[model samples]
Target chain A: MPSTAEPDALSAGAKRGRPGYDQDSVLNVAVQVFNKHGYDATSMGLLAENLGISKSAIYHHVPSKGDLLRLALDQALVPLEAISEHERARTGTAEERLEFFLRSTIRVLIERQPYVTLLLRLRGNTEIERTALERRRAVDRKVADLVVEAQREGTLREDIDPRTTTRLLFGTINSMVEWFRPDGPAGAQQVEDNAITMMLDGLHTRNL
Target chain B: MPSTAEPDALSAGAKRGRPGYDQDSVLNVAVQVFNKHGYDATSMGLLAENLGISKSAIYHHVPSKGDLLRLALDQALVPLEAISEHERARTGTAEERLEFFLRSTIRVLIERQPYVTLLLRLRGNTEIERTALERRRAVDRKVADLVVEAQREGTLREDIDPRTTTRLLFGTINSMVEWFRPDGPAGAQQVEDNAITMMLDGLHTRNL
Candidate 1:
């Protein structure tokens, strides 16, 4: 879609070429702008202005605003998909795997706060939003599957429905984006420890 | 502020009078429209159109869009504040009080789904939004205090921060707005039972 075919265009560098920015850096700038002004209010021109590049240069890296949203979603989703494949996630008791999933989720929220916030707030008004929501739901279902396995193994309670428990867990974890700040008193490590304690042990005293 | 100054104006039949709508009915329609088009995007004129009333007549019951938001927020908050004053919340042990709080919360969320949904989505963009958020935070702090008191009583784990536990509990409870459909399979009673069980007893088996 870009005039990548005119390979020499890079050396020519449009007369106003402030500086060269890579695609990843451009995408990061676009995501921030998108989050701040909101998706519908944002324009490629605003992104170009923020990145100190020509609109044509912004186009060179990403085709459209929707494409930037898709890229940001990948930033959030790829890490989650990786968690499902991790050795800890793949070869553990259901409870153990679920804990690992939650811990990984906290780290992702800290590491990708803006992108994850965007993902959580997306209203499903567009094609990109709907696709992102589907991905999020699929990830949630994987956690629900673990809840089922854990319950079936007699580790989790059979009284509560697996689907309900899964939603509760996801809600608790996803809410980290609302308040978790790495620079705040609680670090990611602290959040992970507290989340694991609350999820696996609950708030009730387990006094020995 | 409305020309309710023209009290006789009503008897005069509002020159262009249309079918009248009551305050509660108007609030309900406004909440749905606000949810659909977003609070900032929705105008009094649009609300008037939705309710099939004259713009001036719409102003008679509610002074402004801000007033509608405040009224809707009251619907969500008054019930919650009342929960804090309930006999159970006031007289029970900390854990019992906490349980009452959660149960009451589930009922309010179910009975006022649309209003609660709007409350959850509000972003604190205006004066009314900020006040609503403050009220919400106060309610959250009350739950945290109960967790602290319960932990001190040795009924809850002292290991996890009370604030963290409260946030997790609120997250799980508030998320009902996302998937709850009164007509759907899960009933309010079922949700309450499941929430209390998972939250109090946790997912693990007691091995009885």
Candidate 2:
């Protein structure tokens, strides 16, 4: 009888069948298709067609659609997770810590663009999606806790609720997925810098 | 051969045992159902079942799923259209006018919460969605223009691009649809006030 790890063994065993089609290649294609057609709307047939491969051939790499989603979300989750544990994020003044987290989060989104796009779009209709959502929200809560602490230290404005501030702060960053084309004039670093500047200084000039 | 102008005639000619239901009530039910299950995933059968009406009765109010989508998009578009023509939106200092436009836009969103939720969730896969998205982008351009004017006038910071600022500003407001529960402690006004404060004051506190 095959063990529970048999699927992984089977997927890894086929190292040369598809010629340059590894787990990463499959995931790249799957994430693109998922972003375009939506996770629920995408079918294995459509995915196979997009990959220019047969259904069984595609199955050799990933177990199912949900596994691809898991892989995609994990790639996006790592950067934000890193920020929570990073030394700079932990050992700075409230303002500096908050800034580090924000800049790091944006850098992660830029680096893992497609994965984070898929991560932000998950609607929780599937167990994989719900788990991804919970993990992302935990990341958000960690940042929100930092912001709340910043507010308590009289660094951030006290009028707005910390939760709302967190949403607005991340909302500005998340909406970039919808409009921020990679081929634009501004590079990712510039985008991150400008976003941090806006969050920190706002639109109005400091004098007025 | 009754004219479509006659609401009573439309109601009477509606194919159902219950003659009281109009297009408005059926649309209300359809929007609610659509919000729960998404526009593409929702079936006419499910909407009819939820409405306690027959498929033909549902069809009498709207020709197809696209028609219902058009109606929902119209609700969101109407407010923006109004804001464009608003006198205050045209005449104030760029920052003040933009604030007025944003505050009004938020009020409209809260008032038309469900329809706006549907509009915001739309992906431009279909002609109807594409047109709605184009109009949304046009409204964004108008706001971006205001930001640019403010920058020129030395009211707003010059470092950030006006277009990115507009996206983040509107994105922050639009995200209210995702987490906001009307049943929560903060009502729409409170939310608006906080959003205004955040947009104007930002997350960081200044000595001034």
Candidate 3:
């Protein structure tokens, strides 16, 4: 929960060598810890201690543990939000748009890796968790609509249901967080490209 | 918590006028109720009352609340255990084995629907939950080993990492318990066929 106010306290209150740690830097560390130990298991006190700051000092910018959750989910939400408005997604043939949307999503998830990972792990145990789940499903429904659009355009196989396909596709994408470690063997671009190719091959029309 | 001890008592304890009311039938009702209310949320008192039996009579069959969980997880674990030794799973080509594995997994999961659903939702808070999770992961790792084998054989896509692919595939398959109702629009066969087709198409050589 280290927010802007806590950083202000470092300079204004009693602290030495506080460095240039800002709200975002603190958030980065918090997300890493949250991903490592699940949200329920993580405590604000642990986060503050990790930041080498007092509990009160950590309360400057964010209000509570849930505030940090909202921020993390917001980060995860923006990329898919962008996808719906992207020109490639909006103006292209159904296959082209769908592929672009998917590839872009994978890329965003990789780049925002930990935040998206945290977002993916929410289980609706709290209000923030419930909201995150809802937002995720909203994104899912939008993607499903795109799939349905592809079906209507005769661009996807008629045999597969769009809703089921979309769930499988996103399920694959959402799972990136579980295994894709940035420090691991595969590079981000490599992961995104490989997933996109496998997905496209699975979903695209034979003629295409 | 019904154990082998009180089968006679459990059977004799059933209400009269229903010819088929036996311990198995009673256990079926217990499982459904347990699943709906959750293990911790349910009590023997509530269960016995639901069954129109005295608590002592209910205790004649099951030893404790945990016994039901054992039975439920036991039921779910059987199909998964069966798959590891499946003839086709062992002797076939990797792709063939994986396809059969996927199809069979879906069928088993559907057949053991309530039990597996309970297994899937376990939070790992108790010894039971942790054991179930460990076992589930062991089953998962077995599948992961097959993916690794498939990758080594050059049968599956080498572009996407096998572990990631396994998680994604299982995530999709597991999420079925969330929305898949037996009496819904799609029957079990329809779901199985579509799931396999989508998975295979996504998994197989694109040009094929």
Best by lDDT: 2
DockQ of each: 0.46, 0.50, 0.24
Model 3 CAPRI rating = acceptable
Residue B37's lDDT in candidate 1: 80
- Which docking category, incorrect, acceptable, medium or high, applies to candidate 2? medium
lDDT, candidate 1, A29-57, per-residue tens: 77778777778878887877787667887
Clashes, model 1: 0
Q: Is the docking of candidate 1 incorrect, acceptable, medium or high quality?
A: acceptable
Q: What digit string (tens of lDDT, one per residue) describes model 2 on residues B2-44?
A: 1212344356444554464676666666778888888887898
- Candidate 3 matches the true fold with a TM-score of 0.73
In the range B1-208, model 3's lDDT, one tens digit per residue, is 3342233433544554333346565677677777767677779888876676677665666787788678778788878878979789889777777777778888888888878888876767789879888988888887788777877776776666676667667866786766677887778888877676665565222334
| Candidates in descending TM-score order | 2, 1, 3
Q: At residue B108, give the lDDT of candidate 3.
A: 81
Off by over 4 Å in 3: A1-22, A25-59, A64-66, A121-134, A202-208, B1-61, B64-66, B121-130, B148-160, B203-208
Model 2, TM vs. native: 0.89
Per-model lDDT: 0.79, 0.79, 0.73
TM-score winner between 1 and 2, please give it: 2
* Cα lDDT tens digits for candidate 3, A130-174: 988898888788788888887788767777767667766776677
| Candidate No. with top DockQ | 2
Q: Which stretches of candidate 2 lie over 4 Å from their true place?
A: A1-17, A206-208, B1-20
TM-score of each: 0.87, 0.89, 0.73
Q: Please list the residue runs of candidate 1 whose C-alpha ends up more than 4 Å from where it truly belongs after superposition.
A: A1-20, A52-54, A206-208, B1-20, B206-208
